[model samples]
Target: MTDYPVSNAAQAASSAYRLASLDQEFLLGDSTRGVRFQLEYQKAQEALRAYGVVSMLVVFGSARVRENGAGRQAFWYAEARAFGRIASLEGGALGGPPYANVVATGGGPGTMEAANRGAHEAGAPTIGFNITLPREQEPNPYTTPALTFRFHYFAMRKMHFAMHAKALVVFPGGFGTFDELFELLTLSQTGKTPRIPIVLVDQDYWRKVIDWRALRENGMVSADDLGLVEFADDGADAWAILKRAGIDAAPTVNNFPLGGT
Candidate 1:
């Protein structure tokens, strides 16, 4: 029998077919970043489409607010849960496949947990677009496993959030929340995306945190821009606003494309 050289075995091991997962040099290289982004978008889009997520009610809030925390934290959590429940039940999320107006969140603790928990309680499927943060963001237990997703890029994640959004309910939050809120607002303002109901929960909190009047006064934003956001004191109020905006708990055909297509 002829003895094969050791180099042959090494070369065969490095072949494309054998080195797929081990090809970190190509996978993680800068040249493949766009491919990575596309993969992330496609993966999430396919999963959501399989579940028939026609549209979403995007919920933005702080990950730090707790159910038992002091001041309005508990209230915010409870209200968020209630909103999720109401939206899920009314928005046709629990009815059947091709769920519409399902509650979607950042998939973290605090308000994200509350909203997801609410939808779970309503027996509705929910989506959690979790990100890999240095602080280690974990998907909230309440997120529907079939619809839950993890992403490395914030832009792609945000794209998913706004892609099929039918409405936005923003609770008091920190930088992360603000980032999401402003992104939607900018999209709405510029007509970059379709118009959707935008409700800011807790008028008092929002007024204090964001100087809407000041923004208009400074000529930084137009008066019509201020009209883009509505205030809701609680869950009921938020739901009412959404309803008036034509987002009923009833199921409707989703005209929006999946995965921000």
Candidate 2:
């Protein structure tokens, strides 16, 4: 009688092949990076769509600004929180499905936490787009778990940020905040995106940090570019700017299309 070789478990497993969802090796490979980017975008898009989040009020600020910390840190936190609450209350976030002007943040501590916490206080669903970093940025506890997302790619995350945004309220922050603010400014300047309400809280801080006059004088940025950002000293002021930009403070329904269409 001839002896036949029997297939082992490992061999059988290999022969069966791994499902796409379970195939980490292939998914993480260099060749599949584009697919990963698409996956990241699609996942967040689908989740937000399911929640009927059609428009967003994005808040960008320092992750380092603490609630009880010194030198305007606490003030920034309080203002951001207030803005989140006010926007959610007026933007149809608390009304029902097809939530509009929902508060969104970077999903880390400091200002991000403050904004999300405010929305939570108003009893509205909020979004947190947390990114992976070497320093390990953690999502704030106040963010709605179902709407919170972890992103491996910053570009994809930024795309999501701009996609649904109807307004942007920027508070005092550092390099990361500056990066996001400038990118949106560029988009608005170039007419790459629709003109959305962009407000910088604390005129004193912004004027000192960014010399709009100098930029216009030096011809680095046009006068029109400088007009793109409005200054607001407080939450109510910021909301007023948004209201003037055609965002109803109290809308019966969110008729704005997704992606600001």
For candidate 1, the 10 contiguous residues with the lowest summed lDDT are: 252-261
lDDT of 1 by residue, 29-102 (tens): 79889989989988998898788887899999999999999999999999999999988888778777768899
Residue 189, candidate 1: alpha-carbon lDDT: 91
Task: Note the Cα lDDT for every prediction shown.
Answer: 0.89, 0.87
TM-score for each model: 0.93, 0.91
Candidate 2, which segments miss by more than 4 Å at Cα?
1-10, 13-16, 249-261
Model 1 residue 189 CA deviation (Å) reads 0.4
Total clashing pairs for each candidate: 2, 0
lDDT of 1: 0.89
lDDT of 2 by residue, 1-261 (tens): 345486465854782487877789878989999999999988998998898887889999999999999999989999999998988888779876878888999999999999999999999999999999999998999999999999999999988887778889999988999999998888778776777889999999999998889999999998788889999998888988898888863433222235444
Model 2 clash pairs are: none
